[model samples]
Target: MKHFYKAMIGLDLTEMDDILIKKTIVYLDFLGIEKCYFVHVAKDLAVPDEILRNHPELLAPGDESIEALIKNKLREFDFPASMDIEVSAEEGSHPLDTFLRWAKIKDVDLIIMGRKEELAGTGSLAKGVATKAPCSVLLLQEKRPPGLPKKIMIPSDFSDHTDLIYDFGERISKEMGAELVPVHLYEVPQGYSKTGKTFEEFSEIMKKNAQDDFNRFIQKFNHNGLTCRFILNDGEGQGKALLEEAKLIEADMILLGSRGRTKSAAILLGSVAEKVVLANNILPMLIFKKKGETMGFFEALFKV
Candidate 1:
């Protein structure tokens, strides 16, 4: 349950709120983050040349930068003596690109930000960063708990990535003294009855297989002081099912494995991670692409 020392937090000016900053602070404290950077990219703000000449008051004073404003808000929270903070505000046509560049330049271990529903020019920057960023990315929507999350939900399909997701959830749960809930959803595909088995029979077999996998997954972890539980749900549409389960258990956060699906697979069947991120904007989601499973150039360029 070691902490992420260096972190970068991205801020959306339009969605700025005290709660988001407060949550960032809580996460920093929870992780014992040593150094933190806050960054905000101001979208295109075109003003007429005539207005600038006549209306001088329209522009902020020299000392009143957006980064300064965000830093002032962050002052409301209590940071540890060991932690240092920095802030940046930039204007760019591509906010996502700006965020990635800053993150790479800084070599941050974690990137935090709020999820945007839909902006005119930027179409889900959170999704883009989650998919392409070198380090782990955390995307939070509004209305999270004031403090560190108490219960975290992790989705699993029993792939090689499942163990990584579970390990992350376990670390967070142990560090924050939260509960880790692993959810696995399964459903039989259509036309499976052609195998001569009833739909109910097929479903039962699939559920059994999922349960066995879930059991095997848990056996690998040592749940010494952690409260870990497994949830086996029956249905298709992993994103929808995950949302329903999170609500059912009242989960405060979600941990997912990035690069969980291929581009063609996502297009044909719809990606679970993308759907959940898009559908559940209120919950905080941490997406991690495992160390060796990096995305290729074309995939990073055009996948989202």
Candidate 2:
């Protein structure tokens, strides 16, 4: 199905956070829809139990503090309320599980979440969800401060999932019409950058490779049909490199496949993809998940 109402459920509340929320609000507003839900799940036990017991109080007069606070947040964005504001509280050990459950129950077409840091490996949240979740995820990432969209940076490694954008990025990018910046960032070649910044020595080769990848993808489509800018970097983190390139190009958004190479190595790798989603800049983002590579045998049978 298609996602009509947009919702976000994270609260590290920063400039980058605001940017993503703001962008969602803008899109919903433009669509002339008012029933969007922006859920702020209180994962911690800090909220008093007394308040939890009186769950109805969220909408009660004088008890409307939280409700108003949430509405005020929406109002701040110039988005109108079409559906009654609903606040839910639940006790759960893992925030990801709680969110996934809620998303399933609500039949949410899109799930928006923010990451505080972009750590790699088994600990990443963004990577985890994008890989396993039942719905499409929009990870609002801000590397730089909130800014206008002069570019839209897409980080890819030519993997099946990342390049399998005929549906995800293609549909969204058409609506955005911002510069489709396709970036390929590689780690420095083993022998080079032995001591200093890894990008120092291998930058040129990476740039050339980026150009080749750009041409290859372009050839897959009609030339001069879509406007875009190409870039490359040899660096430590692909996420960080994408953010820097976003700022350099004054990008308005970032589109990427949620997890990286190790998507199936463990649980959802939403956290792995979190690096790009948690930027300080207010750029909107869309994260897609390609469950697995199409097996050659399966492809041949299907073609038959």
Candidate 3:
């Protein structure tokens, strides 16, 4: 079964666009992506009057030039003839709004974009789309090597969210022949000694309890014959611990589940997911969201 049939890729006209497009092609088969929409949104597409006067040879409209440029960049890649590809260069005061609108209009199942690290970018656009897009978002780090992931790390709290995370992980693992490493971070309570146990003993007990919870959770899904790792938080935050574990295991991709936001909440993404998205600059991260789960909320929020 295909998880992502259609995807929208956000391009900033920076070098990152090359990385994003290349990675998308690499994972197109693994993701079961049949169609891709390459979209670039600028704050203002109109060329400045001074620059236009200085260079009268540039007569084409701003959007048309950008669209042509993107098309030319894509021509360098030999995409499958069966793939449906389209490019759009648009103007919007807020690029995020334009991205979300185009994503909804196209009914994309996933949004692919890049996260800047060594590159000269704040990565705010990637974060905004990951948090607010109606579909799942794949963030490719600017410095990371572009290819299919060998090991996919998933952080599980053993909640309903874990189910979603595992579902995606298993699908990707099966399709791409990657290994699934489910990681669960457990913490001992501050007052564990009150239970008449030493800190070390309590830590072991907490670990055991986490293992038990994981076993129960895993029973619900097939998991493609994989195991879950139980780690002690050791005072660090969950987000930090997750990244550390990903490094220790040499995971190339991090799969996370976003609980999304309610109508009253100010933020759309959960705090842990946001932290991971911001701090992670080495690994490609896939922030999965159940399609249409928050469509009503987004439509109202964006006034669609």
Model 3, runs deviating above 4 Å: 47-58, 80-82, 193-196, 222-224, 260-267
lDDT of 3 by residue, 1-304 (tens): 4789999999987788888778788888878899999998889887657646755665788977767767777887765668899989888898898889899899899999998888788888898888778888999888787788899998777875667778777877887788999888888898887889998999999999888877777776655376888888888777788899999999999998776334333226677777778778779999888876757766787763
Query: Model 1, 87: alpha-carbon shift in Å?
Result: 1.4
- 175 in model 1: Cα distance from truth in Å? 2.6
- For candidate 3, the per-residue lDDT at 47 reads 61
Q: What TM-score do all the candidates reach, one by one? A: 0.78, 0.62, 0.88
Q: Where in model 2 is the C-alpha error above 4 Å?
A: 1-23, 30-35, 43-79, 83-85, 114-133, 139-150, 163-167, 191-210, 221-235, 259-274, 278-282, 290-304
Query: Residues 31-60, candidate 1, lDDT per residue (tens digit)?
Result: 667888888765553433563465455466
Models, CA RMSD each:
5.2, 8.1, 3.2
What's the lDDT for all of these models? 0.66, 0.52, 0.81
Top TM-score prediction, candidate number: 3
Give the least accurate 10-residue stretch of model 3, judged by summed lDDT. 259-268
Residue 273 deviation, candidate 1, in Å? 1.9
lDDT of 2: 0.52
